[model samples]
Target: MSASDWQKSSYCGEGESCIHIAHAAVDHTVRLTESGDPAGVILSATPHAFAALLDAVKENHA
Candidate 1:
């Protein structure tokens, strides 16, 4: 995918340690990477897993 396909998180700060997320329509997976290491490694997760992670984060914050 191209860099244009990725979107920076709204919570991102004006620093290198920002989060970027993208969707892969081919395999139906959500991709994530850190702005500081955009060219380094990428992490892929299923939509369900990603949702679960968000839910857990929300629960903890609640």
Candidate 2:
């Protein structure tokens, strides 16, 4: 993938080492990787799994 395919949200503001998220053009799955370790680890999730993760995070934060 090209550099342009990767994206980060501006919601993080400045000085944040947030992870970058990109969706696969072929499978429509989510891809996750930290900016700090671009070549390190990558985590992929299906739409349903990702949604469940969001729900869990919201519940924990609440």
Candidate 3:
């Protein structure tokens, strides 16, 4: 997906550390810090990889 299409995560809840995500064009998901401009560097990964990352974060937090 285009970087222009990514929206900040709703879970961010007005925080500065939020991340933006988009699935508007490509099958791969893109992520970037909300504090950066839309043109900022983005990390791309498959949905499964992203899910695994989330799971790892949850596990670490728990």
Writing each residue's lDDT as its tens digit, candidate 2 over 1-62 gives 45566677555656537777777778888777766343533788898998899899889999
* lDDT over C-alpha atoms for residue 58 of model 2: 84
Report the candidate with higher lDDT, 2 versus 3.
2
Candidate 1 per-residue lDDT, tens place, 1-62, comes to 77777888899989757888888789999888887444643788999999998899899999
Report the Cα lDDT for candidate 1.
0.82
Number of clashes in every candidate structure? 0, 0, 1
TM-score of each: 0.82, 0.71, 0.61
Prediction 2 TM-score vs. true: 0.71
RMSD of each: 1.9, 2.5, 3.0
> In candidate 1, how many Å is residue 55 off?
0.4
Give the higher-lDDT candidate: 1 or 3: 1
Q: Which stretches of candidate 1 lie over 4 Å from their true place?
A: 36-41
